[model samples]
Target chain A: MGLSHQSIINMQPDVQLVAVCDSTRFVLDMLEKYTGVRVYNNLSKMLQSEDLDAVIIATPSKFHGPMVRECLEHNLHVFCEKPYCLDVTEGERLAELAKQKGLVNQVGYHYRFVGAFQEVKRLLDIGAIGDVAHIKAEAYGPVVLRPSGSSWRNQRSEGGGCLYDYAAHPLNLVNWYFGMPESVGGTVMNKIFSADSEDEIYATLRFGSGLSGQLSVNWSDESYRRMTTKISISGTRGRIYADRQECQVYLRDGGNLPDGYLSGWNVRYTTELTPEVWAYVRGEEYSAQLDYFVQRIKAKEMDNINSFTSALQTDRLMRMLIDDSEREPIAASGDYQPLAKGNSSWWQRLTNAS
Target chain B: MDKVLFGDNQFFGVNHMSEEKARAQSMRFRDTQAMIDVLDMAYEAGIKTFMCTTHERIGEVCDYFRKHADRYPDYRFYPGMPYAHKYANAVTDHGIVGAIKRFLPNDGLMDAVVRGGSAVAKKEIDGIATLLIDAEMKMFEGLSTPVIFLQNVVTDFLLGLGMKDAFRVFADHVKTRYNAEPGFFSMNMPRLLDVLEEVGVENPIICSNINKIGFRMCGGVDLYQQILAQRQFRPVAMSVLASGAIPPREAIEYVCQLPKIESIVFGASSRGNIRQTKALIDEFMAVRQD
Candidate 1:
C-alpha cells in the first residue's frame, strides 16, 4: 500500500513527495538511492526535520493511533491507512483531537471511492432500494492459505487478522451505509489457518432503524485471485447487489426510481460510473481518495468522506464484534436424559409392547 | 495476432462467474500435464497464439513448449508483464528493494541495478519500467512472444495517473529492445485509445472487455462501439462471454460483427469448449469477411 501511494504521489502534479520514512533499512536505502528523496528510520526525527503540511501513515493497524496522534500533534493533516485504530476509545479520542484541531484528517477506506459502491450509496440515499431491511456484507480472499510464520497481518495484536485486514472493507462500507449497529449477536471468529488470529468471521448486526445485516468474511478462500468484497441489500421494494466491478439493483413497481434504473433490474458497471482520476495506481479509488485528501486540505475543508470520525464508527463496530464473540454461550446447566426415567408414559408403554 | 487466441485464466483459478467452478478448474489443472493437455487441445484446434500472464507456473509451460518445439512449431506467446501477485508476495517476503532485486534478470545484476538506481536518481521512470519489463520477460526467453502486453492493472493505473509518457516508454522499450509490438490490456478501451494516440502509438493493439451486455466495458457499450468504428487501432476483444452471462454464440457474434475487432481471446478448460468457441469464432469471422 505504501508503494502504491508512492507511485500515485509521484504522478500527482500538486503533490511533492519530499521525504519517506520506513523501518526497513533496505527499503529506505533503495528509495533514497533511486528517488533521491530523504529517508528516515525514526518518525519523530523525520517529522522534526521536514517542514511538511501533512503525513500519510501506511503502517500496521496497531501503530495507527500513536502515529496519527503524533502527526496531529505536529499540526499536520493526516491520511492514515484503514482499520483506523485497534482500540475504539483511542480512535474516538484521536478523532476528537483532530476535530478540535481542525485538521484535514482522512482514513484509508479506499472502497468508499469505488464507483459501483458509490452508486449503491447513491441509490440507497435516494431510497432506490426502498427502506433496506436486510444486508449481507462479505469479503473473501486467498491471503493466508497456510500459516508459514508470524507476520503483522496474521497476528491478533498487529493487524487483527481477517477481522481487520479483510472484513474491515465490507464492514466499513456497511458502516458507511448504515452508521452503526444498535447491537450485535451470534458473532463468531474462527481460526482456520492462522494460529494466533481468526481467518474467518461471522456476525449479525441490527441497526437503530431496525435494519439487519450479516457480516461474512474469510481470508483463506483460495478460489479468489484477490480480495473480493461484496454487499447485497434486500429492501421492501427492491434489492441491490454490489461489488468493485458493478452494481445490480432490482426494484419492484411501487417505489420511486432513479433516472436510469427500471422496475425490474438495472446494472451499472464501474467503468461508466467511475470518474477519471488524474493519477491511478492499484485502483481509481486509491488515487481518488488521495486526491480528495489533498484537495480538502488545500481548501481547508475538515469534513470529508472517510474522515477519522467515520472510521471510528467502523472501529467501534469491530470492537462490538470482538466483544460479542468473546461472550460465553448460553448453555443449560443440567443435562437431560432422553426419557427422564418416569416422564414418558406413552414411550414407556410402546417400549414395553416392543 | 490471430482471430482466435487462447487465455490462461482458467488454468489459474479465475472464474469470475462462480467460485465453485474456479475451484474445480484450479484442482483439475494442479498437474502441469493437465494444463498442457488443454493447451495441446487448443493447438490442435488451430489456435496458435497463447496470450498469457507471466505467472511463475508459466515458466514450466514455457519449458514444456521449449522441449516439444518440433511438436508445435507455430506456437506463439503474447506474454503480459509483472504478474502482480508475484511482486506483491515478494514485497511481503522481502522488502521493496529486495523484491526488485529478486526479480531482476539473474544475468545482468549489476547493470540492471545501476540502470534502475540511475533511473530513480534522475527521476526517469522509463529505465525502471524497462528493467522490470526485462525481468518479467526473462521467463519468456527463447520463446516466440510477438506481442507483449501491459496488464490492465498497471495500464489503467498509468492511464488514471495521466502518465502518457510512460506508455510511450513501454512501447518504445518493447519495440526497440524486444522487437515486439506493445499491446495494452485495459478495462476502458476508449480512454486507453485516447492516451495511446496522444503517445503516438499508431494503430496499436489494445485488448479489453467487449461483451454484448456491456459487461466490464468501462465507457459503456455504445462508446466502445463508436471508438471501434472511428479509432484507428487494433481492438482485441476479451471477456466477450461476460463470465458466462451471455450465450457463447451470441457473445462471439456480437464482438465479431463489431468494426475493427482484430482478435478475440477466450479460455476454456475442456477440449469440447475450446473446439466449440474456436469453431464459433471462425464461423463468425468467415461470415463477417464475406
Candidate 2:
C-alpha cells in the first residue's frame, strides 16, 4: 500500500491524499504514518470532505463497487483495482454511470501497461505467428491460497475466490492481446482448497478471425509463487508461443534477428513490479493507468463509464461460470485438438456430441 | 508504368453517421476521404494506378473520380474487398462450428470447433455473405466503374481451411451463378496456385497481397518474408513502405534495390506526403535508368 500509494501520490502531487480507508485499519494507519495523511474509518466522511481531485480504489473485491460508486457520484475520476467489481452487472452499471456522467474511469488491466505484452501485440500485428490458426493459454499458480480459516476471499460474498479473483489477471490480458471471443464456455473445478469460489476454470474462446483458443487457470499448487501463463498461437507462416507473464515470444524460425530477439525476455519479462511501474508512472511510452484517467479528463475523453463495457464482458462470463450448477473438470493438458469437422447442430450436437 | 496505386483502410463512411455531431466529425475526421483527396493530389503529382479497399461509399467515391476522369483517364483504380469481415459474418451466421463442419468433411474437426468458442458465430457468417453479396452487386451494377474486386484472400476462410479444391468448386459455382469476374485481388500465392490448378482458373488477375505478413490462419513474420522472396507469385506490391512506416526516400531506395519488384503502391494521407512520394518516385526511376 505504501509503494502503490507513493506512486500515485508522486504522479498527482497537486492532489492531496486526504484520507486512507480500509476495513483493516492497519494498512490505513500505515499509509497515514508514512505519508502523514489523515486516516478515516469511513469512506463516506472521506468523500464528503477533503476537496479531492480523484480517488484511487485499492480495496478488496466487495468494497470495490460501492466505493467506486460513492467516488463517482461525487464526480471523482476513478482508477480502481482489477475485477473492478465481483460480477459484470455491477461493473457494467458503474461503467455506464461513469460514462453517462462523463467521468474518466480506468480498470487495472496492468498487463497492458507492461512493455513485454505491448511487444507481443506489435509482433502479432506484424504477423509474428503467421495467420494465428489457434492459441492455447494456461495460467497456473496458488496466489489465492489461504490457511484453513475464515477469510473474506474464500467466501463468495467477499468476491474472494479463484475464478473471480485470481483468474481476472489472465482473462484481462487475454482480452487485451486478442479481442473478446465470439462465445465462451468453461469448466470450473474446486479441488485445491475447497472454498465457495472455484479453484480451477478451463475456458475456451473463439475470435472473429476463426482462430480458437483454450485457457486453463488452476489455484492448486505447492510451488514458490510460480505463475506460468503461456499462449501458443499457430498461423500459416509459423507458430508463436508467448510466456505471458514474462512477455517472451518464442518463434518457430529466426527473423531479421534471432528467435526471441524482439525484447524483454526471461526474468526481466516476468518481473511485474517496481522500476517498470515507476517508468509507467513517469510516462515513457508505458501506461500510467492513473494518468490515463487524468489525460482523458483533460482531453474531454471521459464522457461515459460505458467506455469500459467491452473490458467488463469477461467479468460477466466469470460470474456466469460461478453461478453455473454443473461443474466439469478438465484434465490439465496444454495440448489442443483442432476440430476435424464443423458444428451443424445445437441440441443434437450437445446430445450426440460424442 | 501507366498506373499508380493508392491503398486506404477504413471502418465506416461519413454517410453512415446519422447524428449531426457525428456527421460533422465524419467530414472533419474521415480517414478515407482524407486519403482520397491525397490520392487525387498524387494524380496531379503524376500518379495513375490507384488501389483501395472496398467501402460502403462505393457510389460516392466512383462518382467523385468519374467526374474528374478526364483529368485521370489513364488511372486504374482497384477497390479490394474486406474478406475478414465476410469470414467474421459467416462464422457468426452459420454457427462457426456448423460452417466448418459443412465445409470440412471430417467429423472430429466438427466436435473441436463446436467446443471451441472461437469459431465464428452463425450471425457473423451470414453478415459476411450478405456484405459480400452487397459488394458484389455494387460491383456488377458498376456503382464504381469497372469495380475492381481486390480479392481479399488474406483473411477470408473461403480460401484458407486448406480448401483449394472446395474454393475451385465454390469459384465455379460463383461464376456460373453470378456471371462476373470475381477472382481478382491479392491472395496467398501457394493456396491460389493450388486452387487455380485444381479449378483450371486461368483468368489473369492482379495480385494485391504485398507488405502484409502471414496468411489468415498461420505463421510468423519471418516465414512471410521468406515466402515473399521464394514464392513464384508476382503481385502488384501494395504497402511498399511496409504500412508507411519506412520514409519515402528509404522505401524508394529499397524498392529500387529489389529485383522483379514491378510497381509500387503509394499511400499518402496528405497532399504534402503525396508530393514527397512523387519526388521519391522521380528519384527512384532516375536511379533505376542510370
Candidate 3:
C-alpha cells in the first residue's frame, strides 16, 4: 500500500516524495537505492527530519491509531489506509482531534472511487431504484488458501484478518450508501483456513425505516483469483446489482426512471462510466482517491469524501459485528426432544417390515 | 505481431464480467493437459502466437513446448512480464530480499544477485528494473519470444509515476538483452502513446481494450478513436469482445475498421469459439483490406 502511495505521489505534479519510512531494512534499502528517496526506520525521525504538508500512513491496522494521532499532533494532514482503526473509541477520538485541529483527514476506502460503484451511488441518490428495501454486500478472495505462518494479516490483533482486510471494502461501500445501520444481528465469524482469526464473516444489519442488508465475506475462497466485492440492492420499484466491472439495474413499469435509463434492465460498464484520470495504476480508483486527497489538502477543505468521520462509521459497524458475533446463541428454556430421536424406533420397525 | 493471438485469461479464472464463469473456467482448466489441449486447438487453427502471462502454471506450458518441440514448429509466445500476483504472493511468503532471490534466474544467480546489490548501491533504477525483467523472462528462455510485453499493471504504474525514463530503460534492455521488440500493455493507450513517443520508442506495439463498448478503455471511445486515427503506434487490440459483452461480429468489425490495429488477442476455452472468432477476424480483416 505504501508503494502504491509512493508511486502516485511521484506522479502527482504538485507532490514530491521526499522520504519513506518502513521497518523492513530491505524495503528501505531498495527504495532509497533505486528511487533515491531518503529512507528511515523510525517514524519520529522521519517526521522531525522532513518538512511535509501531509503524511500517508499505509501501515498495519494496530499502528494506525498511534501513527495517525502522532501525525495529527504534528498538525499535518493525514491519508491513512482503510480499516482506519481497530478500536472504535480511538477512531472516534482521532476523528474529533483531526476535526478540532482543522487538518484534512481521509481514509483509503477506494471502492468509493470505482466508477461502477459511484454510478450506483448516483442512481440511488436520484432514487432510480426507489426506496431500497434490502441490500446484499459480498466480498470473496483467495488470500489464505491454507494455514500459514503468522503474519500481521492473519493475526487478529494486527491486521484484523479477513473481517478487516477483505470485508471492510464492501462494508465501507455499504456505509457509504446507507450512512449507518441501526443495529446488527446474526453475525458469524467463521474460520476456514487461518487459525488465529476468522476467514469468513456473515452478518445481518438493520438500517433506518426497516431497510435491512446482509454482509457476506470470505477470504479463503480459492475460486477467485483476487478479491471480488459486489453489492445488490432490491427496492420496491427496482433492483440494482453492481460489482467492480459493471452495474445492472432493473426498474419496474410505471416508475420514475432517470434519463438514459428505461423502465427495464439497464447495464453500464466501467469503461464508459469511468472518466479518464491524469494517471493510472492498477485501477483509476486508486490514483483518483489519492488525487482527491491531495486536492483537498491543497484547498484546505475539511469536509470531503471518505473523511475520518466516514471511516469511523465503518469502524463502529465492524465493532458492532464483533460484539454481535460474540453474543451467546439463544438456548431452549424447556426440555425439547428431536423428532428424529423420538421417532427412531418407529422408523426402525418400518424398515424391518420393509 | 500476429494478426490474432491467443490469450490465457480463461485458463486462469480472470473473467472481468462474471465471477461465476471465471470460476467454472478455472475449474475446467485446473490440469496442465486441459490447457495444453486448448493451446493445441489454437495452434491447429492457424493462430500461432500465444500471448500469455508468466504465471507459474505457464512454466509447465513452456516445458511441454520444449519437450515436444516437433509438435509446435512455428509456435511463438508473447509473454507479459512480472505477473503482479506472483510477486505479491512471493513478497508475502518471503520478504523483499528473499522474494528477489527466489525469482532470479538460476543460471546467473550469483551474478544477478550481485548486480541487484550493486544496482541498489549505484542508485541505478534501470539496472534493478532490468534485473526483475530478466527474472520474469526466465520461463521463456530458449523459446521464441519475438515481442516481450510489460504487463499493464506495471506499465501503467510506471506511467502513473511519470517515469518516462523507465520506459526507455525497458525498451533498451529488451532490445539489447533478449533481441526482442518491447510491447506495452496499458489501460490508457493515448497517454501511454504520448509517453512512449517522449521516450523515443518508435512505432511501438501497444495492447489495450478496444471493443465496441470501450470496456476498460481509458479516455473513452472517442479519445481512443481519435488517437488510433492520428497516432503512429502499432495498436494490438485486447478485450475486443469486452468480456463477451459485445457480440463477436460487432466486436471484430469495430476493431477491424480501426485505422492502426496490428493484432487482436482473444481467449476461448473451446475449439468452436476459437474457430469462430478466428474466422470472424479473418473475414473482417480481408473485407477491410479490400
Evaluate fnat for each of the predicted models and list the values in order.
0.12, 0.00, 0.34
Residue B89 miss distance in model 2 (angstroms): 48
Instruction: Kindly list the per-residue Cα lDDT of model 3 for residues B18-97, writing each as its tens digit.
Output: 66677799889999999999999998899999999999999999999999888888899999987899787777756666
Better of 1 and 2 by lDDT: 1
TM-score of chain B, candidates 1 onward in order:
0.95, 0.59, 0.95
The lDDT per prediction is 0.85, 0.54, 0.87
Better of 1 and 2 by TM-score: 1
RMSD of 2: 27.7
Q: Which residue window of length 10 is worst by lDDT in model 3 chain B?
A: B100-109
Candidates 1 and 3 compared: the better one by lDDT is 3
The candidate that achieves the highest TM-score relative to the unseen native structure: 3
- Worst 10-residue stretch by lDDT in candidate 3 chain A? A335-344
Q: Residue B164 error for model 3, in Å?
A: 6.2
For candidate 1, the lDDT comes to: 0.85
Q: Compared with the true structure, what per-residue lDDT tens digits does model 1 show for residues B1-290? A: 79999999999887765455677988999889998999999999999999999988999999999999999888999998768886786676455666766765656579787888776556566777889998889888889999999998788766754567789989999999889999999876887888799879988999998998875666578898998888789999999988877889999999999998899999998889999999999999988852
Model 1, span A38-131: residue lDDT tens: 8899999999999999889998789999999999999999999999988888898999999999999999999999899999898889988777
